[model samples]
Target: MFKVLMIEDDALIGDMVKMFLKEEGFIVTRKTNGADGIEALSRFNPDLILLDWVLPDMDGLSVCREIRRVSQVPIMIVSMKNKVAERVDALVAGADDFMSKPFSMHELIARANALIRRSKLSIGTDADFNAPTLSVSAIAAAPVSAMKPAASVEVPAEEKIRLDVNTRSMRVHGKHVDTTYSEFEIMKCFVNHPGRVYSREDLLQTVRGIDSFVTERAIDVHIANLRKKIEDNPKEPKWIRTVWGVGYKFIPM
Candidate 1:
């Protein structure tokens, strides 16, 4: 069972979340303030942390930063601030994910499970594990060896961009393109959807997960980075194009 540390001052909210998490089979340790939260960290040895943005003794961002300085125990921030900038700020301060206030308990539990799964993968504890929530594109792109020959269709000739899930690598125009995890997820969103126009909001939820609250500007930055690696002319992007009023789409030429 995964252990979770929740630092939230609202007694009602704390109890509510704790009860639900316990039902999910997580061992939860609740603390009301930053000092207590910090103190509980070592004692609890939590697999993940559910931290609130506002606390009695101090802001949670500081606590998050402090924790990251010592450990990579996944930190998911809970905040009333839902603005894109505020969400980005939390992420920059060392949060692994963010949940806006009035969040559904169902989504919260699902996100926690994902974080724990990936955390285990990162620590070499679950290398063969893939979170089941990933889209169909992920399963379809797995190594040919993993799929039956009849189901392992050949890559389309018109599709210039390709992904190898077995290697977690991508290729554009027959050249390998290196990617960060965020950029890779963004690419996956496009590859999976084809002509579908995804809003910035859609990408955030799909690429980062439902619990993630992030700036649309963060998406733009990632797109820019991805273009530099894949596009022959970053100014005239070929694979990823801005949808003008909309978000972005992946168009393989």
Candidate 2:
């Protein structure tokens, strides 16, 4: 189920919206103030956020800024301020979208779902990405290699990380890029969807089967290993930069 963090001070509205969203198939966490909403991040790890502009303790814009500092989770500002300037300000403060007050519960749910869907795909944009899914049955049948190995074959090299899926071998910068099975598949995903961000959850789901119990840290470890091989300066990675508070994205030249 998709998780949502809502920061709304209006008790009646907050309660009603939370109940409505729950009915729409979301695990909702409601916070009355910005500070509590900020603290909820560690606990909730929401896929999307619905922030009210005015909060009892602090402005919601600060919450947006703070969340954006560490994560690229989708944020939508729901406010009484209907001006274009207010919407632009919210976006400038790192919100992905905006909704004026007096919104339908159904519309709110639809927008929340849309944001979560977009966040999973990359971050802000919403282009349909058919990220290949690994089946649990396939995982159980095969070793944890993530991909089956095959005999080597000759092929022309691309200007980027070239993966010969049949053999599952890879090449980068005209040289054979040595990689383990998991690393090769990860690279294949990145190269296939260059410029798209993949959160740890995303990488975990795509690289491993959705039903797999792999921890998020395992994704980080694998990424570190891959960066060491691919980046000239892993500390200052060029090809795969960390989108703080987000995940990783392949930067194509």
lDDT tens digits, residue span 131-172, model 1 = 222223443455535432132335654456776544446776
Give all candidates' CA lDDT scores: 0.74, 0.69
Best-fitting candidate, scored by lDDT: 1
The local distance difference test score of model 1 is 0.74
Off by over 4 Å in 2: 123-253
lDDT of 2 by residue, 1-253 (tens): 8888999999998998889888888899999999899999988898888999999999999988888666656777888898766665665565656778887776777767655663454321344432332222222234434443333323333354555543345566667665543455577667656677889888866644322224566567668878887788888889888989999988766
TM-score of 1: 0.57
